[model samples]
Target: MTTTPSLSRTDWTLILSLALLTFVLGTSEFVIVGILPDIADGLSISIATAGTLVSAFAITFAIGTPLTMSFTSHLPKRKLMLTLTAAFIVFNLFSSLAPTYGILLVLRMMTAVVTGVLISLAMLVASESVPTGKRGIAVSFIFGGFTMANVFGVPLGTFIGQRTGWETTFLLTTTLGVIAFFAVYRVVPSQLTSVKTSIADQLRLLTNPRILIAFFIPAFGFGATYVVYTYLVPILKGVLGVPVAWISPILFAYGFISIFSNMAAGKIASHNPIGRLRFVFLIQALVLAALYVTTSNVTLGLINIALMSFMAILLTTSTQIYLIDLAEKFNPDAKGLASSLMPVASNVGIGMGSALGGLVYANAPVMTLALVAGAVALVTALLTAVSHQLDQR
Candidate 1:
């Protein structure tokens, strides 16, 4: 509960390492989108079948995070993190060496399993390392790794694939995972031990409406963002008529904006999370709408894509902070569940957003997908307001 712990020299070392690991995990999760075609080609699979790799990771993450938290409840946070990092190293290596699509699927699923534990603990460590007033900022710093992965990792992964091969990026990330293991082992300190509880108690704590809704704000808010993002490369090339060479640069720009917006969300969240969340959704809605109209022009389309990407994750930090705060206030025992569920909800959002986009794919043009995404934002804003009103009373 003191910044003293998080700011201490050792904590910074741990934070950097944890952030780097997250960057690696985040890259693995997203690099699929960029290299989907390449993976498909290498495995002699269809694009849709290759896309299942992304779906599989989400499914595993959704089921995996809480199960991991409940099962590891008795383990020391340090031990659990180290174990997860080791698993990350192994699975990433498995993915790198995977020869067939079947093997790749299994390796990715394994990666998802460890990802659940690693991500959940990373958030908890970051939050607990700081004072309550500074929790938002600390959580922001940790998640900043995730955002940066999208910015730096995905692009770099794409570069490796373009230059050498898609497999090369996996090799690069696997090496990063090995380094992260050492970092976690050396730097991250043990958390105050928790009284172990059965899964039933964890379930009871998870059933609270506020927790469920708080989770939904994130699940759907960013879900809406992914509806467009998941297929951004296709939208850029197919609809906007941009060349392949141009798509990556636009994505890089979008990533740059996301980094700044993520920090902005932290500041705005510290003021009033609920209100800022509503404002963020509203901005996202407008930006998505603007993108739909500009899809015919490569330059204009690029600008709006960056704008929407900047605002898309604006509520992620606020939503996490809100849930953690809610859990501490009411069911103090559920903080771990609440922290772990944030990423689970995020994975769910990604699945839902992608499914929604896939549905619209048959109905209309790519630009219509942007409008569908905008609608999701509007609905999320309403839910945010409704949940706030309920909490106030």
Candidate 2:
């Protein structure tokens, strides 16, 4: 019989530190959505142009993560995380000081590359530190930091940005990064490491058809949400007729609900990842579709927004577990690559969804984001079914 690893105070501290780092990183990534209008005005750019910052960050993160993980696979986890955190701090500070829209865009892409690496590595660290039975909880704890960012960080950042300026929001992220750097440096053990694999092996694992399909599931599922989320501020202001002051509160509620959803997904995912994902995708698709009908009423629109937020991230932990397990099954040596790809797939979805949302916003009524997103969620559900069948076989 297997025994659970006995964790000491240090282990718990390490886990919590990683979670805190993710909170900081997630806030850096997501806070921009709340302050995009401010960014546009500050830089004298169109809101559409400002929206490209999201796409730029997502695309860079998607492309950079696997490559970075492959190259750094042999490095000591503690050193690698510290280096990434240091870079994150420097770049976020620069982002706050960016003099032009173009400069800010470039800075965001650089920050995103580091953000991607940090998230994947944190998961790897958590999984390695904990017993198999507790890995799901560990992952959930890390993700809890992310959900908390949405719950408290994003809304608070938005409020600060609205009052003081968007630069202040980035500065706050920089402060958080500084805290993360210290926590990681002090708490994360330097000896933590993963199985080393050759570049060729990592590349081969990434090319597997099953793994590729798994990757695309998140791309579409998350893309479905980003379709509407990229323009959430505008939607609240225009469609729901919500006052600017009320937007942050509503987002806070949406984000708070997401925390519970994320935790629940983590717990359920360990038991039946494919089944949980299938159910989540179906509900998400339905919620998004309901948005088309409900968004005209302020109360209903807020409720729909909350529902969508709750449903949108339910697959995250499951997808992460599924990809890691699949990679280990196919090539244990390439597990790092597999683990790294989860966020890559997610960012790809974000980029696609946000870019598509931009197009829809330009050409159609803003409410149409829900329809487009709903269709994409349906596609995600189909992908989940296919993945489950493949797993069963």
Clashing pairs in 2: none
For each candidate, the alpha-carbon lDDT, in order, equals 0.80, 0.87
Model 1 bad stretches (over 4 Å): 1-11, 41-44, 162-167, 294-300
20-107: candidate 1 lDDT, tens digit per residue: 8788889878887778888888879999999889889989988978887877776788888888888888787777778999999988
Best by TM-score: 1
Maximum-lDDT candidate: 2
| Backbone clashes (count) for model 2 | 0
User: How many clashes in each candidate?
Assistant: 0, 0
Candidate 2 local lDDT, 1-393, one digit each (tens): 967666677778978899899999989999998899999999999999999998788778888888888888888888889999999999999989999999999999999989999999998888777777677777878888888887788878889999999999999999999999999988887777666778887878978989988999888988999999989999999988999999867876777888888888777776878877887888899999898889889889888898898887888877887888898799887777888887888778887898899999999988888999999999999999999998989
Root-mean-square deviation of every model:
2.8, 2.8
Clashing pairs in 1: none
